[model samples]
Target: MIPYTLPEVLRLVWSLVWQQIVQHAQVVAWSLFRRHHQAVAQVYHYKRRLALNTS
Candidate 1:
C-alpha cells in the first residue's frame, strides 16, 4: 500500500467531507420536497371534498 503524503491525506479528507455535506444537503432537500408535495396534496383533497359537500 502506498503511504499517503500530507497533501494527499488532506485532499482525501476534504473529498470525504464534501461528499458527506452534499449527501446531507440532498437528503434535506428531498425531505422538504416531500413535505411540500404532501401539503399541496392535502390542500387539494380538502378543497375537492368541500366542493363536493357544497354541491
Candidate 2:
C-alpha cells in the first residue's frame, strides 16, 4: 500500500468534495432555471388565453 502524507490525503478528499459540490450546484441551478422558464411560459399562455377570451 502506498502511504499518502497528511496533506496529500487532505487534498484528495478536498478535490472529491469540491467535485460533488460543483455537481450538486449545477443540478440545482439547472432545475431552478427550468422552473423559472416554465413559470414564465405558463404566464405567457395564460395572458394569451385571457386576451383571446376578452376579444
Candidate 3:
C-alpha cells in the first residue's frame, strides 16, 4: 500500500470536513424554507376560512 504524506492526509480530511459542513448547511436551509412555507400556508388558509365564515 502506498503511504500518504502529511499534506495529502490533511487535504483529504479538510475536504471531508468541508463536504460535511456544506451538507449540514443545506439541510438547515431546506428545513427553514419548508417551515416558512408551511407557516405562510397556514396563515392563508386561516384567513380564507375567516373570510368565508363572515360572509
Model 1 clash number:
0
Candidate 1 segments exceeding 4 Å error: 1-22
Cα shift from native, residue 31, model 1 (Å): 0.2
List runs of model 3 lying over 4 Å from the truth.
1-22
Residue range 7-50, candidate 1, lDDT tens digits: 99899988887655558889999999999999999999999999
Colliding pairs, model 1:
none
**All candidates: TM-score:** 0.59, 0.59, 0.60
lDDT tens string, model 3, 1-55?
A: 8999999999998888765555888999999999999999999999999999999
Q: Which digits, one per residue and each the tens of the lDDT, describe model 2 over residues 9-52?
A: 89998888765555888999999999999999999999999999
Q: What is the lDDT of residue 12 in candidate 3?
A: 99
Which residue pairs in model 2 clash with each other? none
